[model samples]
Target: MTDQPAAESTTTITLHLWLDVVCPWCYIAKRRVQAAIGLFERPHDVTLVTRSWELHPDLQPGTGGPVDHDARVPGESVAPGEQRVRIEEAAVDHEIRFEWARAVRANTFDAHRLCALALELGGPALQSAMVERCFAAHFTEGLALDDHDVLQRISAEAGLDERRVAAVLASDDYAANVRADEEAGRRLGATRVPFLVANRTASASDLQSVEDYLGVLREVVTESA
Candidate 1:
C-alpha cells in the first residue's frame, strides 16, 4: 500500500481598497501606498485593486446641498469663510489640494462601475489612468464624477473608449463585482473609505500613515515566506 500525502497550498495577498470617488484622502493614500511599494525591495509580488464604496449613494444632482463652506467640509457645520482659512492651513500638512469651493460630490456608483470596466478591458494601466482622472475630476476640475456623463468623458480622457465606458456606466454591468468588493469590505469591517487589506487578511484599506502601511506590508511578505 502506498501512503497518501497532503497537498500544499500557496496563495498571494491581494490588497483590496474600498474607495469613494469624492474622497480626496483616498487619492493621497493611493499615491503614498504606491510609493511605499516602489520602495520595497520586492515590489513585484504585490497586487492592488480598487473597490467601490460610494460616499453619498442617495445623493441626487442639482439638488444636493453644498458643503457648509466653500472649500470647507461639512461634518460639524462651520462658517464657510472661516473654514477656508483652516483648510488652507490643513492643505500644507496634507500636501494636496482640497478645493472644496469647487467640489460637488455625488453618487459614485456609476464611476465605480467605470473603474471596474477599465480594469477588465486594459488591466492596471487602464485602472491607473482612471484613478488619475477621478482625482483630477474632483480636485482640479471640481467636476461631479458620480454622473454617468462626467465619468464617460473622464474615461475617454484616460484613453478608454467612449462607447465602452458609456456602456459600462449605462447600468450595473460590473455592479456585481462592485457589490462583491463592498461585501468584502463589510466583512472586513471597513467603516471608512481607503481601507487597505494585505494578503488574505481583512484589514481596513482606508486612510493610514505611509510608514505604518509599509510596515504592515513588509510583515506580510515576511510571514508568507
Candidate 2:
C-alpha cells in the first residue's frame, strides 16, 4: 500500500495521467501505477484521468516501415515476428497485451480524437477500455487501427457505437483536441515515447521505477495533504 500525509479532511487529491494509446511502455506504466495506488487505504479518492497524447501522430495510414526506415518505406515487417513476441512478453509481465505488430503504425490522431470524446463522456474507464482494445487489435490481432472495419470492431468492443465511431473517425470532430494534446506535449518538453510527468513536479530520466514515482507523488500529495 502507498502512503501520503494524513489530510486535513477537506483537501481532495487528483491524479492526471498523460498517455497515448499506441505507446507500449505507457500501457505498462498504467498497470504499475494502478497496483501502487491500490496499496492506499482509500484509493478511490486518488482519482486518475488520462489525457490524450500521440507517440507518432504523423504516422500515415500505413507507416512505421520495417525494422529500418528503408524496410519500412518498402513495406512493414510481417506481424513484426520476433518484435511482436517481445511486446507480448512485456505486456504479460504487466498483465496486459500490446498487439501493435511493429510493422503497422497507423495514424493515431483519429483514435486520440475518439478518446477525447470518451474522456468527456465516461472519463478514464471508457478510454482505458479503448486503449486496451487498440493495443490488442494492433499488436495481437495485427489489425489496422485506421481501418473502419477494425476500428468499428474495437469501438463496439469498448461499448461505443460502431456507427458513431465510424462517423467520428471519418470527420474531424476532435481533431483540434488531438492537435492540442500534441502541442501541449511539446510545450511540456515531451520529446519521446513513454514520457511521464507526476503532478507536473517530478519525472524519471529513463525508464522509471515505481518507487521513485511514488516518492514524487508522495512528495507532492503529502506536502499539500
Candidate 3:
C-alpha cells in the first residue's frame, strides 16, 4: 500500500492555575501567563483552567483590614511589601494597575464559588472573564468582595447570567468545587497561591517574568511531542 500522509496533531495543553482572587501576585501571575499564551505559536491549542485557593479561608467574611504587605508569603522568601513593589514595577509593563493602598484582605470563598459557577455554566472562556472581572473588582476598583451586591455587579459585568449568578450566590452552590480545588492544590504540594501546573506533569511556582512562563509552556509542549 502507498504511504499515507501524517495525521494532523490534536494535542491540547491544559494549564491549571491555583490562585487566590485577593492575592496581588496571583493577579500578576495570571496576567503574565496570559501574555505568554498570546505569544505562543499554537495559542489556540492551549486551555487555561483557573482553580481556587483561598489565602485566608478562616478569616470571617466581613472582617479584613487594609492590605498588610509586610506579612509573610508562604512560598516566597521576600516580604510581601517588597514583593508587592516588585510586582507593581513589573505590572507596569503589562498595563496592570495595582491599587495596593485600597486593597483589603477579605475571605474569598464566595468569590471562588462564583468562579466555579462560571466554569460550570460557560466553560473556560466565561470562567476566565469572571476571574478577570473579580480580580479587577478587588485589585483595581477596591470593591468589597465579601459583599454580595458587589459580587452581583461584578458577575453581571463579566457576562454571567444575572439570575444564575444570584442563585449561585444566594445558596452555597459550588462551595464543594472550591474546596476540591484547594484540596487538589494541597495534594500537589501547594502552600501558596499561583501554583501552576502544566499538563499534569511539569510545574512552576516562581515565575518572575513573561519569558519565564513562556519557557515553561514551551517545555511542556516539547515534552508532549
| Candidate 2: C-alpha lDDT | 0.61
Write model 3 residue lDDT over 98-211, tens digit each, in one string: 787888878889999999999988999999999999889888888878889999999999988999989988898899999899999889878777888988877878445677
lDDT of each: 0.68, 0.61, 0.82
lDDT of 1 by residue, 1-225 (tens): 111111221335566667776776577677767766676555676677777887777787544545443443433456647755654553455456766777775667777788888888888668777877887788778887766677878899988988888777665699887788888888887777778887754354445656656666666655554
Q: Lowest lDDT 10-mer window, candidate 2?
A: 67-76
TM-score of each: 0.80, 0.77, 0.90
Ten consecutive residues with minimal summed lDDT in candidate 3?
Answer: 1-10
TM match of model 2 to true structure = 0.77
Descending-TM-score candidate ranking: 3, 1, 2
Tens digit of per-residue lDDT, candidate 2, span 124-182: 77877787777666655667676666777778888776667878877888888877876
Q: Candidate 3: which stretches are off by over 4 Å?
A: 1-10, 72-76, 79-81
lDDT of 1: 0.68
Which regions of candidate 1 fall more than 4 Å away from where they truly are? 1-13, 68-95, 202-206
Report the Cα lDDT for residue 2, model 1. 12
* Candidate 1 lDDT for residue 222: 55
> Which candidate model has the greater TM-score, 2 or 3?
3
Q: Between which residue pairs do clashes occur in model 2?
A: 1-39, 65-72, 66-72, 99-138, 99-139, 99-140, 100-138, 100-139
